[model samples]
Target: MKYIWIYAVIPVVYSIMFFSVRGGFLKSAHMLNIRFLSGLSIDDGSVRTALLVIFAANIAAAVITVTGHLGSTAEDGYLLREDYNGQTYTQNLELSISGEERPIEIEVAPRSYSETEKEAILSRAAMKIESIILEGQSAGHINQDLKLISSYEEMPIVISWVTDRPDILDWDGKICRGIPEEGTDVVLTASLEWGELEKEVTIPLTIFPKELTGDEALREKVNEAVSSSNNSEDEKLILPDKIDGKNVVWHSAGSGQGLIVLFAGLLFAALFMFSRIQNRDIQEAKRQEALLYDYPHLVNKLVLLLNAGMSMRAAFEKTAHDYRISLKNGGPKREGFDEIL
Candidate 1:
């Protein structure tokens, strides 16, 4: 009987009761000035149908969310359901984070908060802070120099911006009002995060600003300032720009000994190299003239050896030895006799 009530009786009876209801349940109850105990209202046939659909949908969603939260499903596989919330469209109801080995299934529903929820959220925030400290070490907000100041009434939240934005502090924080101590230069820690999400969060430091100064010292110093230009009558000279853009004082002098010495050194080096090259050229010409005379004699000897039916090697050797003897007799020398042969 319980199983029948659970499965068959509940569904059938619930549907029948819904169809047999007289007018709209909400309207009828409101007219009688009676309150209905149900969380959902079956105000009209269409509304009843919508509620039934919503109930089935919420049940399916709750089941899906609970299953995902339990991590009892394949990675490639996922369930789908209508959001039905007019504000939000039918997008994938999954929360994807980078470097996450598992795709996290968040319990997607209407965002609501309670005291218990707020506590849980606070605990989560604490965990996040701990994680940041663990990963960041001293590089995080452990050593930052920041100051915040505001009134005592509102416990002002301060947010520092290291971004390219014009302001040093972004719009995330507000100045608290009516502070007991006049706040000025309150010290706070700054943090910067980078990756899939760019999050810049500051860890609240144990420091606050010093009590505000009423600017009396500055006012007194300004009052005592000597504001007279009494030394303005001193003589001055106007200098002219030189042709080479140098402030060269006018003088009746030509080039100095330093310039002369430099010119002489340059001329001596150039003349010395040129003279050596000219001497080398004269020696080369004389050598070429001597070789020209020796060429004809050497050719005659070779012609005689060829007529005498001698081998080319023997002819060349005989000519080279004869040329050496002629050189010993103070005759003009032939070059590369051994090399040419």
Candidate 2:
């Protein structure tokens, strides 16, 4: 009931406000220029379109609100369950208990797998560990870090990793410092277990030093220096003045170079746009001058026709008809007389 009232009142109030802004009634649909409604009067088309939109929005809100609250009446400790299959089932649910203003969220899953099925799932997952341990690099020619996972998600299995050469490759698959220039060999062992079943998988990897460009190597040295300075207990923070063999220069975070570049770009764009606007205005002025070039002659002709006993309407038609004939015969266009026609 609360949800229904909240959703229902919102649409009703919105409809009232929308109509109130347009004279407090659904008499016209103003400011809505839909293409399909071009044939109908603007007011009539807008009124009908507004009513249809409001009706659809209110109906959708009501339906969604009502359906969402249908499961609100579920009791504590009650959860819907799926039929048993080979795979595990889990669902996240939010429960509202009596006298509690906030809902309690919990996860529910059905554990109906047999011992035989569990062992088979774990065995397959353990086999996949060796293929993925290299993390896309070839095992015989590895130069990057490995992706040693603590667990496999396909089955209920916990994995623990151990490396024989811990100095070259840590248990977490990170390549530690001091990798030799000629490369070395390392072995990674993964212990996989599910319930009482346990299996071990070993992967042999040849690790070479991670190749770094000049800039990357310099960046690493600077980062190391900055990290080393972080633990100093000196009164003022000391920054590194040199990295490797190159002299280092420290600049404040608020550098003006970026702002200067941005201002220059904006200035160029503004000048270009201003020039375009000036050209447009100049062209419009010339067009207006051309439109009024023969204005005095037209007025004189109109006055003479009037003095010669022709009606004002007849004089205008005659002038318009003559202009049309002239136009068809490749005469220069006069927009002022075209508007009169």
Candidate 3:
């Protein structure tokens, strides 16, 4: 009979927690319910049934939440924000892939671009190639120094152009020949081959000529005279000795201390939870022990009432009434007598 009250209290407590509590407090109750249900022995059929009901309720709530059946008002409010007006909206909603199409086992060949797309791609590539060649030609033209240097080799030209079918596109290096003479244009040609698609671009280069005569000899004599003067000046230079200094050492602190602290914290938390569970079990055992200890006395009182010309129901009621009065008068509340009441 005492077990009936215990069973009734469990559901009542669960109801209050589910309806009244919110946020982390409610989440903690859910976790505790799951843990308690899992720890119950298989032989305890009544307790197991109660636990199953609570577990099922939690699962149903979770399902409703995930399926967007719950909290519809809050979702609608968030979606109606002013910032979302006239803008595309996206959400991280869960989707079921069960009905999606599956891949077939048949041998299917890879896809290639259509003819129109290939032509558009090739035209864009040609424009990019022409721009690069023109820039290279302007940069590579000899300056007043009359020396020729390939600008293409000095700085790598980055080609931002991409083809739809990169595997088929083949690019050959630009070809130019012969020294550029004064007043003559050097033509450089570049070729790109993709399958049957081919494109070629030609650019003309110009050279600026400067006469070379007695100026070379005069420049050499001036450079030699400047070198001799610099050497003599360098010989007269001096150095200073005896520099002051201080030596300091630094030691790095490792993560070992943090790891130790983390481990200690985890150990303390584990022990605390273990102690709480053990204390709860111990208290329950003490309660059951007290009930068993008072059972014989309660039965003896019931027998005395019955023997004094009282009916069975009257004797039971008298025993329960006396136990309640004693409990009210600061006596121990016997579980066995309370169950009878």
Top of the candidates by lDDT: 2
Model 3: runs farther than 4 Å from truth?
A: 1-17, 20-112, 136-183, 207-341
Query: Per-residue lDDT for 1-341 in model 2, tens only?
Result: 54567776667655654564456233222234334533544464456477668867888978976885575444344665444444344444454558556545554455466888878777888788878776678888777777777778745678999999989988878877668887889988899987788988888888887766788677777778887867667667677887766788888788789999999999999999999999999999987886777687788888998999999999999889999999999998886787678
Off by over 4 Å in 1: 1-256, 335-341
TM-score of 3: 0.25
C-alpha RMSD by candidate, in order:
29.3, 20.6, 30.1
TM-score for all predictions? Answer: 0.23, 0.39, 0.25
Pitting candidate 1 against candidate 2, the one with the higher TM-score is: 2
For model 3, where is the 10-residue window of minimal lDDT?
237-246
Where does the lowest 10-residue lDDT sum fall in candidate 2?
24-33
Candidate 1: tens digits of C-alpha lDDT, residues 1-341: 11222443344544544554455565544544546523354356665675477556655665665555555333445533333231322333344468544434344343334556445544444345433433433322222222232211121223233322212222332233222343223323333221122223444322122223458433333333322212336564333333223344645567598899999999999999999999999998987877777677777888899789888988998887887787789986465453344
Q: What is the lDDT of residue 145 in candidate 3?
A: 29
Candidate 1 TM-score versus the reference: 0.23
